[model samples]
Target: MKLLTLPSFLLLFFETAILSNFVTADTNVHYLDNNEFFKFSNPRQIYGTKPLHIFCYQGKPKYIIHIWQSVILYINHSTDDYNQFDGGSPEHVEKEYLEKRYSWTSGLFSSKSKTFHLNPFNTSCIGIESQDTYSVHLKIIRVDLWNILKLVAGIVFFLSAPTLSKNTLFHYVCGVSSGVCASFLILIYFLSKLFPRKTFMYGVIGAGWTLVIYFLQILWDNMKTILSLYRTYVIWYIVITGTISFILCYRWGPVQNQRTMNLIKWSLQLLGLLLIFFSSHFQEAAMAQVILLLLFTYVPKRWVLAPKMYWKKRFPPKLKPISNDEYYEQGVRETAKALDDLRKYCSSPECNQWKTALKLKDVKRFASFIEGNSHLSDEEILEYETSIREEVTDDSDNGEDAQFSEDESS
Candidate 1:
């Protein structure tokens, strides 16, 4: 006799082709974890210069041209490895930026730096870090004026192509609007990272959203031509279901729990596939429908960049220390509350053991805090660190979320 868990049982019962579809769908979606990269170097060697590369956020991953946000390249001058210039450890590096840690304010390394913005769109680092200098290189994308022009021009050509060298004025206008709006939306996302000042940042976001609404209006008008009653119901179902699922996962999902993450991730893939399949069914409106869905998904989420700094502005509470009891109880899965607790951990006088101190919760905002601070009691820190080590070493733990559907074919 054999007993199987839901995912296993389902996998066994389903046809190989249908199971393959599930696997393929899961693999196609991009996750931030899949792209993380980091490196540290001697500060002086990389000082006063810039290196160029594209990032993942700018577009889909490309050879060397895509903007990437997963890796962070940091140069600490106070390290013992390089005594020629003043070298500092990661902890020492954090001290210099402590005042700005929890706020929405954004700037470069220091006042003496040449670059005004830390995450400049076109250039890499353009500053100095002699006395405890920290030149941070993050994986971020920048869409500049030239890139915008090129994107708009390309969209115009593509929209005109199907018309066989004689495109209607309305089509040309829509193409131009599509390109300009998308590029500007990208610009807003980049600007939010480079300079996260509240008023300016939110203003750009509001304007960009207005443009998005206008674009959606255009798509809706076109959608009416080809959408049958059945397709309309399917689209509305997807829209409502997708919106609810997104809210539930984003608002309540535990950041540290692998199980919750998997559920949210798979749900997104399913929704994306369903939406695309339905949208593409109407040949007359297929291109517009897909384009609208892509833009809708991409535009809003782009501003929520990785790395604690880029997202701090989204959370506005002042950073003050909280007791461990206060943290685990009231702070569990609450971003603002967890961040405040992490601040307490950072501000602790003994904040050098932070990496091994706190437990991993969903509030990844605490990552930078842990990097250089460790203020827990020795016993507490030891316990936390030991649990982390144990978890890392024990690698045979793979489980799936609960079952969702029946086997269509066996």
Candidate 2:
């Protein structure tokens, strides 16, 4: 073959690059949740692609890990590797293909902008070190596991409270039913805020809605009986409880501090319990049932389950490794961009640690795997990053000052 000029070679390479990498749908990826496995074709892009087109506040992408046939993945923070995965790596597939993106809202409004397209990882024409291009030996130092069963139990009790309302509280059952549904709805909203990524968020939201629908249907069926109870005494109960609940929620509902909010919530719950006990319609059965509902619905979740979830979310969990093929997937790329936006909020040391850990083929690959799976929105992620940075910096300064004082005394 005749020698081509450097520019001509580059142009030809670019032209052929569109066909250089081909990824199959069967590529498996491990998610942070240990029990879950993801395929390359369907990477869990939680924030979706809409945020990618906007450059202002992108967040961390899900981690992309590529491996050769002998693949064992691990994630390590500091010196410890806490998680490991084994993907069947019989052989490597090398084929190049063109990629494009399609938005869910494309047809809603006419836009001339073409979806982003690229060619990813066709190693046929070039040779790169395996260690540089893939995760050859992976180790993860720290990861925390969540108890899904506890969350499920909380949800089940929350949804079942309506059933318990039928026999107890007598004339007050209607109000109690409505109140139970409303309280669970509020709890669901708080869980979504607290553990956005966990299945608990979706579970509570769906179950809460189902409970509301069930309650409304029952209310409609028993409207005549319920309204009959709405005479002077019952009406008074309705008005008083409703007013107190409303005032408590309205005043303390928006408070961002979790501990403070929980304190207020528990105090109000105790007051509600006392009110129900002393109400004219109260029966021993009603009191007992109410106690069970509260025990199952609020007690375990607020005091036991939610705090664990909050801890996991605060520290984040393990990251799974993915391949270059998975990294180049449309969903992965957008998520990676979002992750980068979130990473911008981390401290320089943390950011540098990310760079060292991910050893991605490009900066985009390095952008993968945000601290908390990008569950928080971009703004929230930034706030988290800022607080973490300040805390770490302050601690470091304190350490330095103590060291200096000791040295001076010596």
Candidate 3:
């Protein structure tokens, strides 16, 4: 894309404003008691609970995890009379009744957490009112399990699924996943600057970032009323995380060139950081940004020395096996023995590794399997290349062909 034009700048300027007002104006203003800057006061005086036993932020996409947690605390701590809006004196705001956002114009979000549309994670609960004598309990589970789940799934599916990672598919998976992982850490550093969710970045991204993104359905499936205290926690987590994925996929994930690849990653991530404040203000518009972002995701971008770039990015001398000869020697021998058992189970020792490890049969059979997949991946890659080679006019993606190359190189 080119530099922003005058018209483009003006358009985005107003877009950002409208977006900001929409997000901030119609949401809850009092969720936390972070002095007066926050929307709500502490739960100590408001309810009978011993403050919320909230899990401090653990980083990842839910940057404002702490802020959302505080809201849960206040809600869970209130008694029946806390905010009996309709009953008795309609002066008190029930603990269960919370403003959805921090906007001044928007009144409190009366819909229970479980009822919010975006809150597909069946988490929100019916706001229960306990007496001052009853104590409140708010528990926060889930410790970056989503990220781990994704990594495991990707590794297994890519390794097993036929035609999925043939050409350079394997390598591309490695490369893109590596880049994604790196970008996630980078995202934490940059995002923390704006929303400073209290959590250790290292632990959040350690080895579980991908799994957290994967198991989101679990949250969606479990809609327990007691989960009300943690409703904001789950909802905010899904929206921000999903939005980040949407934004990154459209921007950095599609590019080529190591320098450009990293550049695209960092630039978009930072821009998202700046825009996220706007998200809290205008949730809908903030979400729309991703849809607006799709305009660029499929549009092709050019590259120089594309092959060289792919090789260098995907397969450096350091990463290659010390000697393909010795490595494949044993593999070939084992594979050959298994060739004899062709129709039947090839229990040969050599082919045993592939058979057991990959769940393939004899060595020759596994090789055939790999070759079959390679053919399919190759065909797909060729098609991708054909689409992208010609001036990139309404063609396929740049990275689509990279999968084929990954297969060849592997």
Candidate 4:
């Protein structure tokens, strides 16, 4: 049985390989037109600053187009016209700038034609231009059914290789194989835009084999018994859900406040566990529960949270401390202001009555006397009052005739 399996596997592999080769041969033919021809020139007037060889194509959404170039030269693609390269702009002044610009591919020396696969996402037009002085002839072809079939074949081969083994570790092997295949799919999808088709295929095949061998060794050494009980499955499911929740929280939780971030993290974790628990109990609603969990995981946080919640608090700036000289200056200014206000108040007519009520004619003298003498005997206070009254009587007697004449004139 082992010998028969080996021969059958080889036969199946060769059959698929031969069929793929036939498909490639048939799809290699392309229809050409004179209008498709483009010329790139290094004009002496502009010093090769302008990209004369530009081909603009109307592109559809989610469609990938393949480009074949006849010369070894750097290529770039943009969603708009290549008018920016017409002048000696800062963006294209240096040779290295074109190499680092958007959707740029480095030049490679090759005997065969170089191919570029592009996905023009949502752009109405795509402009393909050569960054070098070399004259480039190229063809643009939209990916057709046969090309898609070839891609699907490659993907299937990558995913189905591990299943060929008849070992009891089928589940573990298939899991690892699928993960590696998905990673390669994403990598190839992006790399197809940056590398020629031949270079992209060579890299994918080489990297795929290396990872497959490494993962196989890991699986061989770590094989364990598979738990088959329903209760065990439930516990594993809950643990998996909790772990996914934790990762999501840490990656996409609120960052405006630390406390809010923690609250959101814990809430999501608890909610994930509860959903798993309830889904297990209510088997009929399990699908709905799973859908809800997926929505919570993938939905944009801004759509769920208010716009104001994303705002961060701005703290007031720190003030510099005042020096000793500054402090003394401030104190002097305040004291001068207070004395000016008191002088203005004393000029008013109410000042005489206030001074009489306090039995103090001059505010400065009253303050000095209080500071010097803490207490006074009753007779001393009486004598002080009698002296003030006798002074007042002398002033009144001196001004009596003048005050009486002024009143009569009024």
The prediction achieving the highest TM-score against the true structure is 4
lDDT of 1 by residue, 325-344 (tens): 99777755686667667777
Task: Tell me the whole-model lDDT of each prediction, alpha carbons only.
Answer: 0.42, 0.42, 0.41, 0.44
Lowest-sum lDDT 10-residue window in model 1: 25-34
lDDT of 2 by residue, 165-265 (tens): 33323224344445644755875687689785768778878888876776666666556668788567557756766776655555544345556445544
Ranked candidates, highest TM-score first: 4, 3, 2, 1
Clashes of 3: 41
Candidate 2 global lDDT: 0.42
Write the residue-wise lDDT of candidate 4 on 1-410 in tens digits: 99989999999997797556434321111112323544444444343243322223323333112221111122333222232221122222232324323223433211112233322221111123333443223343333444344334433433343332322244234434444434445555576567667876777766765655565554443333233335586466546654554454446532455554455445445544444433222233434545565576668888767454544324445789999899989997997777666655556675674545477556565454334432345788899999999999999987997899999999
- Alpha-carbon shift of residue 174 in model 1 (angstroms): 4.4
Please give each candidate's TM-score.
0.15, 0.16, 0.19, 0.20
Model 4: what TM-score?
Answer: 0.20
Best-fitting candidate, measured by lDDT?
A: 4
Which residue runs of candidate 3 sit more than 4 Å off their true CA positions? 1-79, 84-131, 134-142, 146-410
